[model samples]
Target: MSIATPQNPALAAALILAATTFIAATTLMAKALGTDVLGTPLHPMQISHGRFLFAFMGISTGVLILRPQFIRPHWGYHIGRTSFGWAGVTLMFASVAYIPLADATAITFLNPVFGMLLAIPLLGERVGPWRWGAALIAMIGAMILLRPTPASFQPAALLALTAAAVMGMELIFIKKLAGREAPLQVLWFNNLLGLAIATCAVLPVWQMPTPAQWGALAALGLLMACAQACFINGMARADASFVAPFSYATLVFAALYDFLGFGAVPDAISVLGAVIILAGAAILAWREGRQRPHDRAPAPAAK
Candidate 1:
């Protein structure tokens, strides 16, 4: 078994930040697609279809250019992971349409917490007090930031909450595949299978996009592909629990994108909640760095 140690934290941080930026941009695009901004709002299924389709094209191009040797994938893990991923993304897209983007994004903060907890069983990663404390504190911060009045928890808000749960589960499969194959190969198979799955789901709801929507879809797909690539590479460099908190950075980018694109400003509660989450993450990350048990460079090439 690979010892649990910190990998290249700096490089991992950089990659994860890039992923959050791309992911936040995709969220913005998804919000636009679900609204009348691009003529008619596309269905969440249709939007996800576009994400997989374009991402596949982009990854396939890379596969051709690099011509890297491929490895046999753990198909079971891939299938489970992709299934959860598609569901989570579709739900996330749907939530953005029914609720404020800030609120939708805030709820997703729980995903990493869910991921950390699930990692205990799924990834067989040991969670110390620091990890548990960090996760709990982040969860509390998320709830506080959400400011759940009786009316605050709208029925539609459940969509984002559910998306978080599904995505938390998605992280397990990602961790499982993190270093088992080439990152590019993993992405290629993921997008290829994702495209097939999305196609089947979108058939009933598919409609030709206006030229503008088509452009938006292309941009969204490319951005999401970049996010996935960064995320996978980042995972290769670090353990999942250690990387979980860094994902909160996405909230920052998400908030910025929502405000810039749609003028959804965050209130003091949102700011306060996010600060607490970051604080917990910071504490955990510091502890992880200090321990440094799993510190080894990646193999020159994945076999």
Candidate 2:
């Protein structure tokens, strides 16, 4: 039987909020896996592999139990989406190892802005002044996080920015898939393909995870799967714009997780940049909500 998901804006936002918690926790897990805190740092590719492999396993089990029916998929869209999603995830794992999780998470809020810009070429969508202005404001916010000055420049932060761009590209494919199939089916195909792609990419960097590392990887994968499921079901129930702002709660959870897990607090710049980015994103989401038809919404939250 398909899961019942009645449209409930309050429930959707709550689910997204739950997803943010899982997402933030996964980053903390990734940071542990990527650094010596858990053991010797794992390669980002290897870490990404763990995420896909274990997430696929968990989702495969669900497929067996739930037995959700699927439509004939758009193979090209799934491949494109999974490939870019895997790359973005790998880059995110790499960045968390080197910078504060709050900084990395804040920087990645650019994905939507990047998605808006990318739509011009990919979807033939026209950009109005509202979108352009929102994108500009968002870019300025990202620059603040980059702290391009010699004294504060952290090159590792660029990985987060690039991840945002790649995820934005993934968003284009996601838009193509939205409303085309059951959300569960889309998710299963995504992780299945993600596993295949990440497995190939990990060959050069693969290492046997330590016992504790293995556990962390397992936790990371499970958390991500849960996050994806909550996000998908949530989006299906509400306008994307209505719940999109709630997703920014990830930064707060990240900062709290980082501090509790590793005692790292968000410094001044992290808070300022994240706030500005939220402002820009809120503008874009508000505008998109007003202009787009009620049926059009983001497919799901891409972690």
Candidate 3:
């Protein structure tokens, strides 16, 4: 039992870190494919559309093989949940192109803070003192990261913040929907929604990608799917908080990829901000681990 705590948490965090790092690296590759190979011709929307198109097909194919009947879900929750995911995907992809990966990822750490705030009203989940303190510290760290001045800030940072906010909303809806459907069903709706929204946003301006660009898009889709799968499996095996902070490892991977692959390195200020982001995530993880003792399945009643 004791072994499960550290062992499972470490395994889950490692899996999540790998998944997120791959996804972050793929984003860097997408930028190269778009700019260098595609001559900066592929719009963000177009890339999103292509990526989601492949993802939807991939998920649909798997569903057909593994669970044929899932082709049609309960339309109401499916549509609702899909909408949240749609917005999250669109916003997140847009941010990826506009912001530095480290900054973008740091802003994303705000999601759980927002989630904690929303839970008080939406889910009736308590915010407790320790979690609230952690959230405050996280927000201060976010301000340092954002800088929020013309000389210091890029407008793209705001986009990443908005992406985080939207992600918070998506997560809330996901939590609500989880009890009603299998996780795979939720994942299917997410991809379908991503495709639908990306199509609606990008179709008017869509230009077909060249073979190389298409290959990059395919790679991007595969990495995105892999990240989602590993994240889900990891969380199922351990606590979300325990697994969440390592998601920040994507920042390290992103920075390294950008430097080696694109010659872009984050500044010292950005590095400090990244540290704060990791600190906040660590605080959240510790809080959850401590709470675990108080959480357990109810004992079976005597006959």
Q: What is the C-alpha local distance difference test score of each model?
A: 0.76, 0.88, 0.67
lDDT of 2 at 177: 75
Best model per lDDT:
2
Span of 10 residues, lowest total lDDT, candidate 2:
293-302
TM-score per candidate:
0.85, 0.96, 0.85
Clashes of each: 3, 0, 0
Candidate 3 lDDT tens digits, 1-303: 011223376677677877777777667755665465455557777777777787777777777888844444566656665665556555656666656777777777777777667666776676677887877787777887888787987776776777676667666665555435554665677788778877898878888777878888887776777677667656656666566666767778878877787677788878888788678767866786676533311110000
- Per-residue lDDT of 50 in model 1: 93
Q: Could you give the C-alpha RMSD of every candidate to the true structure, in order shown?
A: 4.6, 2.2, 6.5
Worst 10 residues of 1 by lDDT: 294-303
Q: After superposing candidate 2, which stretches have Cα over 4 Å from the reference?
A: 1-5, 294-300
**Clash pairs (backbone) in predicted model 3:** none
Between candidates 2 and 3, name the one with more favorable TM-score: 2
| 1 versus 2: better TM-score goes to | 2
lDDT of 2 by residue, 48-68 (tens): 999998888888899999998
Q: Write the per-residue lDDT of candidate 1 for residues 1-303, one digit (tens) a residue.
A: 222335797888788888888888888999999999888899999999999999899888888999998878889878987888889889989988876676677777666567767766666667777777877787777676556798554666678878877888876776666657777878888888888899999999999899999999999999988898888788678754466566767778888899898888877876787777677656665555555454211111100
